[model samples]
Target: MKKLAITCALLSGMVVSQVWADAASDLKSRLDKVSSFHASFTQKVTDGSGNAVQDGQGDLWVKRPNLFNWHMTQPDESVLVSDGKTLWFYNPFVEQATATWLKDATSNTPFMLIARNQSSDWQQYNIKQNGDDFVLTPKSGQRQPQAVHDQRRSGRHYPSVQRRRAG
Candidate 1:
């Protein structure tokens, strides 16, 4: 009876591990297809109580290997660009541009995981499919949850290309 229990436990463990591996693989496969992505976004900032504090619209462009450009056209005129090495935030209204290391800018943002496209990083998130959305929760318990909803009609949707993060 002891041996039977042990064998069953081992088999169950393998099944669970395989399921996780498959989930990760599926997510990675989707992300790998995203070489460049462009989108127009309307963003609303809300407080903890769900009161709208600010609203804005912008155009976003991202290319693989760490290159992104964000242009805000509503509520203000500003631009955030990353050329893989440095991140530049420019505000025409203030007539100022601030530059920071890309690594530093990406540290706390989802862009880090998406632009890096590292499988190791994928392991740090628990990924599951909810209808048409893929939800990602940080395994480290230090970050907010993010969901990826791809509007693409063809091919698998990945993390970086057309991801909508909802916390």
Candidate 2:
């Protein structure tokens, strides 16, 4: 009886593992083919009560093996750039530009999903289908909420990845 129970538990875990990435493959297949891409994005920041705190529109450009330009133009102006090594964030209003190592910036951010097209990148997060998009939450149970939009495929232009961090 104990042997049978152990086998059942192992089998169940195996089955769950195979079916766990319902959204991972979908997102991977959709984005893996592209070498470069760009998308326009609109972001809304809200509080716990869902009240809008800030809004911004931006253009995102990315290339494989870590390279992207994130430019925000609406409500304010800021730019984030990564060139396969260093990451830079510039705020024109504040007249400040901060630079950091690429690894540090994308360590827990879903931007790694887009920047690094590797199985290892997807392994750190749990991706589950939420409606038309997928919500990527850290496996460590962090509160960072990120959405990888997998819109219908059309050449190199895939769906824009939008994320909302909880306040």
Candidate 3:
């Protein structure tokens, strides 16, 4: 009984610390001056059946007010670009590109508000620092259920950004 009580107390303490470690608010404050940023990282895509269909590394660039360029160079090759107004999906094998409105299109899209510091309605996210990078997950209070459903169908995935090694 005593061992069980101690284990329960330890688990509770860990949970509280995890919640307190989220750094979402701090990141939001720094975003004002962040005109453009870039990074290179690996992405693992899992389907609804929990199967890994794709895994690769890529370079990502983002400019304020919703502009992003993602170029995948390994495993498979593809390019996704968003120029604030239109989003483009370019396939090298098909030699074709499809364009759509940034707001209307959805998928396991990396550029969703999951990348932003706010919710779909522009409310700030619940942030947590997971090791070297920060994870920004939405709060239920601000996230609309309908939007969440729509995003799920589109396969929206937002893992925290991983830091790059210094050269």
Candidate 4:
């Protein structure tokens, strides 16, 4: 009886771990194939006080090797578009447009991380499919890397790799 119970426990653990690994690998596969893709999504940004401050719908465009453009059209007119080297943010409410180097920006922000196709294993974070959505939980303070490449092959700027589907 004792041996049977131990074997059952070990098997259960393997099942759970396999499930998690499969989910991660699936997500990675999606990222690996994303050369230029578009997705529409709604995001609810909450504050530290636990109040929902803003909600909006946006479309994402990613053209690899490393170019991404994101525009939020609902709830307000705001935009964040990155040309693989520089990121631009235009907020109509503030009547301001700010630009910064991609290397200095926050790469770990949820939307940016996903749009840029940053996929790491559960050792750095956990990824699970919640229904049709993939819920990614970052482990502690691990920051996602920003893959910023140059436009041309000059060696000074890392050229963004745009993965094209084979004909």
Find the candidate with the highest TM-score and give its number: 2
* Model 2 Cα lDDT, one tens digit per residue, 9-116: 999988766655767887787677777888888887666456677888989888898999999999889999998899999999989999999887777778777778
**Model 1 over residues 36-59: C-alpha lDDT tens digits?**
878787765555355566778888
Which digits, one per residue and each the tens of the lDDT, describe model 4 over residues 34-89?
55666565655555344556667877677764577778899987898888788899
Stretches of candidate 3 above 4 Å error? Answer: 1-22, 45-54, 106-110, 113-126, 137-167
Q: Which pairs of residues have clashing backbones in candidate 4?
A: 64-161, 64-162, 65-160, 65-161, 65-162, 149-158, 150-158, 150-159
Error of 1 at 148 (Å): 1.6
Total residue pair clashes for candidate 3: 5
Most lDDT-accurate candidate = 2
Query: By summed lDDT, which 10 consecutive residues of candidate 2 come out lowest?
Result: 150-159
* Native-structure RMSD, model 2: 3.2
Which residue pairs overlap in candidate 3's backbone?
22-127, 22-128, 107-154, 107-155, 108-155
lDDT of 1: 0.70
In model 4, which range of ten residues has the least summed lDDT? 158-167
User: What are the clashing pairs of model 2?
Assistant: none
TM-score of each: 0.70, 0.80, 0.55, 0.63
Candidate 2: C-alpha lDDT: 0.79
- Candidates in order: C-alpha RMSD to true structure: 4.3, 3.2, 10.6, 11.1
